[model samples]
Target: MAVLNEEQEMLRDMARDWATNKSPVTEFRKVRAAGEPQAFDKGAWNTMAEMGWAGVIIPEAYGGSDFGWLSMGLIVEELGKTLTASPLVASTIAASAIILGGSEDQKSTWLPRLASGELVATLAVDEGPRHAPHSCSTSVSGGKLSGTKAFVQEAHGADLFVVAAKDGLYLVEKGDGVTLSTRKLTDQRSHAEVTFDGTPADSLAGGGESLLDDVLDRARILTACEMLGMAQQVFDTTLDYLKQRVQFNQVLATFQALQHRMADLFGDLAMMRSAVEGGLQALDSGFGVARAATIAKSEANRVLHTMSREGIQLHGGIGMTDEYDIGFYLKRARVLEASWGSSAYLRDRFAKLGGY
Candidate 1:
C-alpha cells in the first residue's frame, strides 16, 4: 500500500466511517428499491461533494483541493466497500478529461461547478459495447456532435458529457439533441445509451493527441481502486463466515482445505492492492501510467472475478439468494469487469504497448 499523508489518512478514515454508518449496503438496497433513472441518492452525493471528494483531483483555483489521484482513489475504494450508488467515479473521470484537454475558458466555465457538485458529468466514449475507445464513431461537424454511445454510466441526471469523437474529445451539455435511453444493468446503478444528434459541442483543444488515452488511464486506475475494495470486502466477509459457519459439526475455518483457499485469496488480495496503488502513484508522478493502469485493472479483473465467485461458493446456498449482500457484489463485479476494459482487452492492450 502507498503511504498516506496525514490528510489523506483522515480522508480515508472519514470515508470509511461514512460508508460504514451513513451509507451501508442497506442504503444501497434502498436506492435499488427506488429504481430512479439516476440510480443514486442525490442527498448522499451532495454530502460527498460537501466533504470535498468531488474536488480531490481538481485544482485549488477551480475551488477543488487539488489533492491528486491517490486521494481520490482512497475515497472511491471505501465507497466501493458498501456498493455505494453514486456517480462520483464517472464525474471524476469526466472532469479529468477536461483538466487534461479543456481550454482555459472551458475550464473556467465548467470546472468550478463540477468541483462544487453543482453539476454532474460523465464520459461517453464507446459506441458499441465492450469499451472500444479506438472505434469511437461519434463525430463533430459544424460545432455539432452526433452519434450513439452505449452503456454510459451515470448518464440519467448528468448535466454535462465529455464525449469522445472520431477526431477528439468534446464537451456537450444535456440539452437540445441529447437524449438518454436507460439500460437496466444487473448492478441496477445509473446506466444509459445516450444519443446525440446535432448537439452543440465544445472541443477540448489541449493535451495533444494523447489526452483521451491519458484520461482513460485515470479511469482504469480509479476503477481498479473500486474493484480492489470489493475484493477486499469479499475476502474479509468470507473469512468471517468460515469462522462462524458450522459445517459437519465443525467450523468451516478449521477445515484444512478451506483454510488453504482463504490463504490463497489473501495473497491475491494483497497483489491487487499493490498493483492498484502503483497505478495511482504513476498518475501522480507522471510516469509509465498506461502500463501501470493495464496491470492494475487486469489484476483487478482477474482477482475480483475469482473473489466474488469464491465468496458465493463458500457461502453456499444463501450466497446466491437476494437476501445476501455477497450476491450483490457479484452482480456489480460483472458490470465493472466489463467496463473500461475486460481482462482480454487489457491483456491485448498491454502487449501492444510493450511492442510485442
Candidate 2:
C-alpha cells in the first residue's frame, strides 16, 4: 500500500465510508434499474459536492481546497471500489485544462463554477475508433467549431466542454449547434457522442497540443488510481467467497490450485499499487509525469484484465450472470481499459516518448 499523509488518509476514509455505506453498489444498481437519464445518482453527486470532493485539486482561490493530485487520486480510488458513478473525475480533469492554459478571465469564470459543482464539465477528444489523439481532424473557423467527439464521459450532464481541435483546445457550452447522443456503456455509466455544427466557441488561451498532453497525462494517472481500487475490491470479494464456498465437500480456499491463482493475484495487486503510487508521486513532484502515467495505466489495464477474467471464472457459472455484481466489475474494467488508451496504445506511446 502507498503511504498516505494525514489529510489524504482522512479524505480516503471519508470517501470509503460514504461510498460503501451511503451509496454502495446496490445504490448504483437502483440507478440502472430506473434508467436514470444522467446515468448516475444525482443525490449522491450533490452529497459529494457538499463534502468538497468535487474540487479536491482546485486552488483555494477557486473555492477549492487545493489538496493536490494525490488527494484527488485517493478519493477516486475509494469511489472506484464501489463503482460510484459521479462526474468528479471528469470535472476535475476539465478544470485542470483551464488552470494550465486558460486566460485570467477564463480561469476566473470557469474554475469557481467547476469547483463548486455548480457546473459539470468534460473533455471531448478522440474522434476515431481507436485512441489516436493526433488523428483529431476537428476544425475551428471564425470562432465556430465543427466536429464529432466520441465516448465522452459524463456528457449527459456536463454544462461545459473542453474540445480538442486541430489548432488548439476550445471551450464550448451546452447550447445551440451542440447535440449529444448517448452511447450506453457496458457498465451502465454515461458516455456520449457529441456533435457540434458551427458552434460558437472561445479559444482557451495558451492551450495547444502540449497542454492537452499534460491534461491527459494527469487524467491517465487518475484513471489508474481508480482501477487499482476496483482490482482490490474484486480480489477481496473473491477471496472471501473462496473461503466460504464449498466444492466437492471442500472449501475452495483450501485447494492448492485455487490458492496459487489467488496468490498470484495478490502479487499483481501489489505491483499495480506501486505503479499507481509512482504515477501519483511523479505528478505531485512535477517530473516524468507522462512516462509515469503511461506506465501506471498500462500496468493497471493488464492487471484488471486478468483479475476481471479470473474473478468470473472463480465464481463459477454465477459470475457470468447479470444477477451477480461480480460481472459488473468485468464490464467496467473493459470500458476503462479502452477509455483513455488501451494497454497496447500506452505501450506504443511510452516507446515513442522514449525515442525508441
Candidate 3:
C-alpha cells in the first residue's frame, strides 16, 4: 500500500465509512432489483456529489478539489469493496478527457456541471464486442459523428458521451440521432450499445494524437483500483469464513492446507496493491503512466481472478448459492476482467510497448 498524506488518508477513511454504512452490497441488490436503465439510485448519486466524490479529480477553479488520481483511487477502492453501482468511474474518466483535451470554451461550459455532478458523462470507444480501440470505424462527416459503440458502461444514464471516432475523440450529447440499446451483462451495472447517426459532434483536439490513449490509460488504472478493492474484500471475507467453518470437528482455518492457500493469496494481494498504487502514483507524477497502468491492471486481473475463484471454492456450497454475498463478487469480477482490456489483451500491449 502507498503511504498516504493526511488529507488522502482522511478521504479514504471517510469513503470506507460511507461505503460500509451507506452503500453496501445490499444497496447494489436494490439497484439490481429496481432494474433501472441507469442501474443506480439517483438519490445515492446525489449524496456522493454532495460529499465531493464526484469532483475528486477536477480542478478547484472548476469546483473540484483537484485531489489527483490517487485520492480518486482511494474512494473507488472503497466503493468496490461494497459492490457499489454508481457512475463515478465512468464519469471521472469522461471528465478527464475534457480536462486533457477540451478547448477553453468547452471546459467553461462542461467542467463546472461535471464537477458538481449535474452532468453525467461516459466514454465510448470500442466499436466491436471487444476493446480494440485502434480498430475504431466510427467517423465524422460534416461535423456529425456516426457509428455504434458496443457495451458502453454507464451509457444509459449519461447526459453526454466522450466518443472515439476515426479522427479523434469527440463530445456528443444524449439527444436527437443518438440511440441506446441496453446490454445487460453479469455485473448488471449500466451498460448499453450506443449508435450515433449524424449526431452533431465537437472534436476534443487539444490533447492531439495521444489523447485517446492517455484517457484510456487513466481508465485502465482506475478500473484496476476497483478490482483491487474486490480482491481485498474476498480475501478478508474468506479468512473469516475459514475461522468459523468447521469440518470433521476441526476448524478449517486450523488446517495446514487451508493456511497455505490463504498465505499464497495474501502474497498475491500485496503484489496487486503495489501495482495498483504505483499506477495511481504514476498518474499523479505524470511519468510512465501507460506502462504503470498496464502493470496495475494486469496484476489486478491475475490476482482478483484467483481470489474470487478461491473465495467461492473455500466457502463450499454456501458460496454458490444466490442467498450468499460471496457469489456476487465472483460475477462482478468476471465482467470487470473483460472491461477496459482483458488479461491477454493487456499482455500483448505491454509486450509491444517494450519492443519485445
Q: What is the lDDT of every predicted structure here?
A: 0.94, 0.90, 0.95
Q: lDDT score, residue 17, model 1?
A: 100
Cα TM-score per model: 0.99, 0.98, 0.99
Per-residue lDDT tens digits for candidate 2, residues 1-356, read 67888988899899999999997889889988988657888888888998998888888988889998888999899999999888898999999999889998998999989888889999999997678877888899999999999989999989999999898888999999999888987889888899999999999877555988988898889988889999999999899999999999999999999999999999999999999999998988999998999999999999999999999999999999888789989999999999789999999999999999
Clashes of each: 0, 0, 0
Q: In model 2, which range of ten residues has the least summed lDDT?
A: 204-213
What residue pairs clash in candidate 3, if any at all? none
Off by over 4 Å in 2: none
Return the clash pairs for model 1, or none: none
Better of 1 and 3 by lDDT: 3
CA error at residue 281 for candidate 1, angstroms: 0.2
* Candidate 3 residue-pair clash tally: 0
lDDT value, candidate 1, whole model: 0.94
Worst 10 residues of 1 by lDDT: 128-137
